[model samples]
Target: MKKLDYQYALKPDWQSDARLEKQTTDNQSNIVNLTLSDNTGFAELNPEQYTWLLSFTYQSTHKKKSGSVCVILENNEQNTVNHRQYFEAGETGTRYLNLSGLLADYQTLSQWQLVYDHCLLMPDATLLGFKKPDIHHGPILIIAPHADDAELAAYGVYSDFSDQVWITTINAGQNVQSLDRQYITGLDDNLKDAVSRKAKIRAWNSMTTPLLAGVKFERLSSLGYFNLTKNTFYNASEKQQNDSVCPELTPAISRALNTMTLPNDESNISSGKRLVDDLASLLDQIKPTSVFVTDPEIDPHPKHIMSAHALALAIQQSGHIPDRVFMYVNHLRKIKKFPYGPEHARTALPPWYESTSKFGHYSCYSHQLTLKTQKEKVVSFDSMHDLRSKPRIQKMLKAWWHKKVLKSGYQFYGYHHYFQTHIKANEVFTFVDGKTFSDSLLQKE
Candidate 1:
């Protein structure tokens, strides 16, 4: 068989891991059996020395229970690290899930073994890539709702093809919640967004940009009712009412114009016009061969939805004709029990329970990545904290890191679970033929 080009293939450790062991279903019981050399239950293991596929068969009893099979490591300090693989209810037979590949760094490679709890429970699990990924030939636009969206959702693809990518941060990332205290204090309404802008810029420069290096980043950030609000676009009915305004720009547009630069100036322009014009111009100039946007249908965040809508409109108006347009899932929000893990390196992406792709001309593909690519993805997060220059940003990341790596407990598990589980797969997109994307994306339920 002709092999695929994967960076991890060249790793000495991966070479040792080339052979895999497969297990058949246990005829004796309805229960799923964990196959391991440690029938004694504790075989000495090294992440580098030991790499094997976790095999499982889905019984009707399982009925589509998809989450993750975690690989947990405990050091002498008793700190824990997690790795997960998600499975859907219907998957069956001997499947290859490599848990040892979870150890992505040298610091994590030393003197460690799987946690008794994760191994003892032995559970079950779950591709996207490109066709002609000479992504550098034309352009690949990464449209992000905020500064960090690209890093969080599409970092692997961005990191691999940095020079070919053009990133556009669509909205001002200033968390309006942070400005609440200032607002009640009678601070000038004008300075609220200014403060938020400064705060976000400080973090972006110190944390986000450096963490995701070698990419061209541009902020076509919008102002006005678009400040930290969801549902920024007017649906068909609302469009008929005001023509230009999205009646529900947010919780309260009357709050104050806190924007720094373009808020007041752009106020005269409706969000729809600004959204169309700004992105249209960007598409015209970049003419990306591949464009990646947030999947409007799945990401429940309002801005995420609106940003997707904006990208659709821009593509429609620009007349640039991109070869491929992709969408991905949100890591933080677990939709209808969707497993949170790394992007899958397979072809043909899966459809969400209610993906809106049917409404447009779109085909999807899931890209499976090498274990090495997944490791680099995790290291990228740490690099931000270690190299960050801003005290405030560094402090924030430090707090988050402490929770993810230090505490084994947090809601829906914790960031530790997310990052560890995340390395296994990724969601990716590709475009379909002959469909006119229109204001349909701007419509409501």
Candidate 2:
């Protein structure tokens, strides 16, 4: 691949001309105050090997300030840089040099320097070599709306990349009562109770069987409560009653209904902050190169909206956003309300459903079957119900099935069935990491 090199001057501006103060200083480090300019120069080295270098300058007030200057980088895509330090500032001077790395591993030399106190300096002093940007290859973390949302939305995609698919549910092993409780108690009391008493062993067995068979199953919580249905009100009185009783829930609910709502708003601000903190911690641990989240605009469900906000906040807080953040469609069954109608609807269909003519039936042997067998094995070992009693076994079976259906992969069956039986759409948002690519380059040649 041919390397591309470009540079622009960071014009002296009002912000860069602001007064500076020395907060602290040491033999090795110095903290100085200086405003940054908006006219920062950006360079794109290559399309495939996307690399960028941003340069700007700030004025210092401290005369003996001779330590390294640190710079932090951030972008809309959630990419960020930890404090990058450069030792280019001269001692006993008001002028401080600002130099930092944006994409450090790329195969091109892109530099920015501080030119006077207000102006930004280019790489006229020293030449840096071009190096290839690091390629990310890791597992994809899919945040499905419900239990089975992953299999319905990206079963084929997961199949295509089975080795790299790590399906996880924001909520898992949920039930109608537990859903009711979240609307009421906002706690995972049922899950804690079940686990404590070991009451829902059959339920857990059935729900987790399919996932363990092929994909890694990670459950955020077994409460399985969704934030969607709780937001909808049948009438004015109901809405008013909810507002009076649970005013705290109104904001998250409102954000779900209103797509234009930003994550920083009052309603989602606290939750957003918590999510950012949590995500920053997760990013430091997982360090995934790419992430998949539901699009809050398209996904009207409150849980989906919250999850999207959380993902965005997490990436921003991490200080190093992944290479890509893909937005997968969550609540496709609600697509009838979309303005584009038929044209937009087609984008939401799964690959299998998109080409029904190619496959005979949607059913395939999976981990779910294994779970059913496990349930029987457990019942036999515990003798929880008499094997000879038909009614008793039938009741246990029903209970087990219900619990199994609550698992992440099984919950999507309801929506998948709706699409298969009714509307046909499978649109999903795929945010590519690195520089944006043209349509022609993305398309198969």
TM-score list, all predictions = 0.53, 0.34
CA deviation > 4 Å runs, candidate 1 = 1-84, 88-136, 178-199, 202-211, 217-225, 228-270, 331-338, 341-351, 354-357, 360-362, 370-372, 379-427, 433-445
lDDT of 1 by residue, 392-444 (tens): 56555655664677542322222333343344444344443212333445344
> Residue-wise lDDT of candidate 2 within 1-445, one digit each (tens)?
1111212211211122222334345423233333322213212333223211222232223333312333322222211111222222232212222222233422221122111221123212221212222223775555554554554345444434555555434332223343233323333455444222222332343235334335444422122222323222111112222222223332232122222223323424223243334445555555666566664444566777656655554564566566655555545443432211111112211111122211111111111112233223222222321112233466555444644853311111122123221121222333434112112122211
lDDT of all the models against the reference?
0.44, 0.33
Candidate 1, number of clashes: 28
Model 2 spans with C-alpha error above 4 angstroms:
1-136, 172-213, 217-277, 332-416, 419-428, 432-445
Tell me model 2's lDDT, rounded to 2 decimals: 0.33
Top-TM-score candidate index: 1
